[model samples]
Target: MNQNQEIRNQLIKLLEGGIAYQPIEELLKDITADEAGKSISHLPYTIWQLLEHMRITLYDILEFCQNPDYQYLKWPDDYWPKEVAPADQETLDKCIAEIKTGIQTMIKLVQDPANDLFKTFSHGEGQTLMREALLVAEHTAYHTGEVIVLRRLLGTWE
Candidate 1:
């Protein structure tokens, strides 16, 4: 595999491990369903919301990379979910699936030599595909750490 493919594969492995090793499912398998949501830290975000945020950002970046003409937009200044919580198992599962799909699509695009990795995309921040992928990986890992921390705080970690 080439450099891009190798990096993509490593990123996929990181994501897969991060999602699968969710403390709630792996470590705290004995915890009751009702108590699974409570955390000592009372994180600003529930696991569900964090997943949603990660998914949305990943999708946005991948979309930008795939479509050169895509318009760029800034994230809202004060955007937090005020309604129902998205931390439920179903939402988390869906987000995981969507994130996986987005990653795969991005990897395929990057693997194509016809696609210019150095070509600048209009991310408002003026990011290139290479830079975007690295940023995505870093962002994903950061959130993955949050997920693990939340799980541990909630006593759901294995």
Candidate 2:
């Protein structure tokens, strides 16, 4: 395999693994909407909020990577969810589905030989395709770990 392919594989592995510990699926599995909304005394957000934030950020980054005309969200505000928990089970399910879809799309984007991974975007400052991909992967992993910790703190993790 070439260097680009190898990097793509590594990114995929990063997304598939738990953020240095448990798998994302393992952490997320069997988590109910109520459990996701549970909050600690000091923490600012719940698992559901964290998950929504992650989904939104990752989606934005993916759009930035793919769309030159993409407009970013208002800093710190639009990046977070308005609700602490999902309104219904279907919303939570859809959030998870969108996150997974974003990851899959990112994997496909990096895997493609047509895209020059190191080339900077013509319309932007000095951002490359690889930089955005890695940023999304890293950000996702950080929040994924947070979600797991929140679950444990809320006594929802099994």
Candidate 3:
């Protein structure tokens, strides 16, 4: 593969997870709504909040990368869910699906040769598609780790 293809492959791997990091798609699977809502004593946000934050942040970053008309979300408010746990199983499943969907979208962007990964976005200061993909991967990995630890605390991890 050429350099651009090589870079895109590496990025797709990173976004898909399981290289030097746990896969959020795998980690998120099998978590119940109750488990998602439960908060450990020290951690301020529950799994639901964490997952929502991941979804919202991913959407924001993806929008920034693709949308010249991108609008900024409010810090902490727009990025986080108000509910500790989802209202029901459907809500929980949707959140997980959204996270996975966002990752897939990121992968598509990286895979597209037309997207010039190194070219900076006109809407932002020095942000490139490469940088945004890395940002999404890093952010999701960070929270996916937290979800694992939280699951262990909640006695849900097998």
Weakest ten-residue segment in model 1 by summed lDDT = 23-32
Q: Could you tell me the lDDT of residue 7 within candidate 2?
A: 86
Q: Which of 2 and 3 is the better model by TM-score?
A: 3
Task: Name the top TM-score candidate.
Answer: 3
**Candidate 3: global Cα-lDDT?**
0.90
Candidate order (TM-score): 3, 2, 1
lDDT of each: 0.61, 0.83, 0.90
Cα TM-score per model: 0.70, 0.92, 0.96
What does the lDDT read for residue 71 in candidate 1?
Answer: 66
Candidate ranking under lDDT, highest first, comes to 3, 2, 1
Indicate the TM-score of model 3: 0.96
| Higher-TM-score candidate of 1 and 2 | 2
lDDT of 2 by residue, 4-110 (tens): 78887787787666547676666667778888888788999998999999899999888888898988789999999889989978888888878888888888888
TM-score of 1: 0.70
Write the number of the candidate with greater lDDT, choosing between 1 and 2.
Answer: 2
Q: What is the C-alpha lDDT profile of model 3 across 80-138, one tens digit per residue?
A: 88889999989989989998999999999999999999998998999999999999989
Q: Candidate 2: minimum summed lDDT over ten consecutive residues — where?
A: 18-27
